[model samples]
Target: MMRREATGEAAPRTPQAGAGPVPAPLVASAVLGGAALLVWPAVFNGYPLVFSDTGGFLHQTLGPLMLWDKPWIYGPLLHAFHWRVTLWAPLAAQALLVSHLLWLAQRALRGTAAPAAHLGLCAALAAASTAPFTVALLMPDLFAPAILLALFLLGPAREAMTGPEAWYLGTVATLGIAAHLAHLPLALALACMAFLLGLPRGRALRDGARTAAPLLAAIVLLLATNWAGHGRPALSPHGATFMLARLQADGPAAAVIRARCPEAGWYLCAFADRLPMDANDFLWASDSPVNRDAEGRARFLGGALIAPEAQAIVAATIAEHPLAVATAVLRNALRQLVTAGIGDTLGDDHLRTALRPRIAEGFPARERAAYDAARQPRGVLREAMMPLAPLHGAALLLSLPLLAAGGLRAWRAGDAVALTFLAMVLAGALANAVATGGLSGVFPRYQARIAWLLPAAAILLLMPRRRS
Candidate 1:
């Protein structure tokens, strides 16, 4: 075990082998109780929260149609859990995954595998951070943080984990990365960092390769699913369309269009006058060029239809205005770092239009009724969550200094565990910000989903070190 802190904190005594084993019922109860607390927001909201994008996930399997916008893995997972009976099943699954990972994280970090301590960690996170809110939502956003936690377990916390536990975390990390397109780069960045940090030791190469294995598997799984569903073996077929909107919102695409239009004869030149619109508006607005034909007629799957052009536009814009693109990306990433809030997760008003029809079409009558009666759809969840925004803000604000102190202490003490934990939390958050904010445009939920790790790391850092 690493050296304990010299703060006069007594080291916890290790349990004797094969002695005082926890009863089976107690372990089950601990997991259930912890999961329940982690998903309290859904219980409070009277339903699992839904997003405008939830319909896209549902469509992947429920519609049996390929969505150009995202990967197809989450759709089948949602189907397996819910089976169209109730959305609660999937929420429960998410909660359980989160709960177990938290248990593992607490056990690995503080060297205390007690159920009560695990529940306490969950309770603290549920009260002060965005864990419950993310878990409650039926979106893939929760997996972003889950992936980071899972990576930490497989990397820094690997020494403390048993074989089965390592496999479980590796599986969770793989699924989490495959669940979202943005997650791939985030995981790769962290895994690469781990490799770089481990350079001094011969085992570093082995450890880095082990950590990266899941990412490689996730890529294969993503491609296989995409091939099965869309007949195209690609990560995201319409990614360029989204990128074009982001660049358009950020100014580079507009500058390129204005400078190269007419003579360039790009399809977007028709709308050069409206080049730099909000990313969301560019993608979803009725009158937006991407959503309309040259004659101003509405088109289904218009984004996908224009993806080739979108890709060209994105490439040209990046090439033509490299400095502007970099500046915009940096600006967006910084904005996203501090933009963590429960903005639209609790609110249903903005999503009702696109979300309602999917529920009507994909679910049974009883499930539809449940959706209609949920606090989110009735505009109550956001109001109930309004007070929590400040709490989350304060928690994150306090975590910054704690993490800085912890990082400094870890560096001075040459503590690999503390350093790896700090690095994963901070780097994952920043990489997420850059991936989602810079490429997809800034949304609070993008960062909010992962921001809980800040407080989680801070709490773990403060705990006295003990042998596992």
Candidate 2:
């Protein structure tokens, strides 16, 4: 028998090793796959500036990059370079982000013998579901997937994180929040997952606080910048009063207001326009005439409003029909989710046409009109899907099951990564619902907002596993 040097005992032979090095071919394939995704737009050229919101986002983000007197708060990376560079910036950023997500999938499935196959399948599903829509756009949709991947990669799993990993996760969380308020829910879900995944509660809370501090600071700084840019607070009392007045109006008119303005700061008018109104809606007929009155238009344009009167009217409506108001809010949240063009330009073809004559550089009228007409089918489908829209409300109604499934899966067997993902899907769905109200006539891009969660849940359900 072989004896140990010091203890004079037989040396024990190690059992067959379970974990293996990541295969070189797998690494090469992943790198190649990522490269393909990065260059997909240039190669295909099928969807350049296709989404309606792309123009606005490009203008907002690239305008600041060019040192134009536009608000930079909306585009955090605006100061990083010249706006002209941003013409290609979205493509490059999206490519890099897609690459990173592919890398994360590799890591998530690292222990599996066929990590490449696992990652390839994940990528395929992600692409089929939402990755295509996101990477194809110039809007913040790409950031959603990037943030989710960052969370999955940096989030604490069954294993403990190294100091660097913790710091990286924190940074990703901060950036995710700053990217868009919509991303906050995912960030929160990640934080919860970290705690549930064996991280000490105190440490988890501390990490969360550290991660959130930068986002809060950035938000404050952005608010200051926006105030300076606008020459006023983001939302002035007059603006608020005007918004309240608009909110008190009926839905059809509110839809018209949103169609015209499309700016969040003018959200009140948009909200009011969305209020449910029949053909003979006479409650706010006085307000309707105000739209045509020069003095009334001047008051609205100048942001001077009868604040108490508007508030009193809205308050009275709520008081008289509390349940109805609550129901409306809920319905609006649902509307917001499946609505196509609430915050986009898809349905704003009329507005685009109006601006075409005034602006030397704008979408060509013919193209804009065609795009608007093309959107009708999507609108019809949305209306047709109205009965099925509540199926999405499962995110709200069955939040507990999803949460429990996600939580339990993340727990007992250390397979909760899927749960974390589903949590985000549900959170985003709920947030969109709350933010916008039920399906507006907008396109389906908003549904892409939570696209990451779909494949994640699918992976959880589809992946073969030994029973615990």
Give the best candidate by TM-score.
1
In model 1, pairs of residues that clash are none
Error of 2 at 113 (Å): 11
Q: Candidate 1 — which residues are off by over 4 angstroms? A: 2-24, 408-414
The local distance difference test score of model 1 is 0.81
TM-score per prediction, in order, is 0.93, 0.58
lDDT tens per residue, model 2, 63-126: 4231122234334452233243323444555555565455443344332324455455546543
Write candidate 1's Cα lDDT for 404-445 as tens digits.
Answer: 887777667656666777888889999999999977888899
TM-score of 1: 0.93
CA lDDT scores, all candidates in order: 0.81, 0.43
After TM-score superposition, what is the CA distance of residue 205 in candidate 2 from its true location, in Å?
2.2
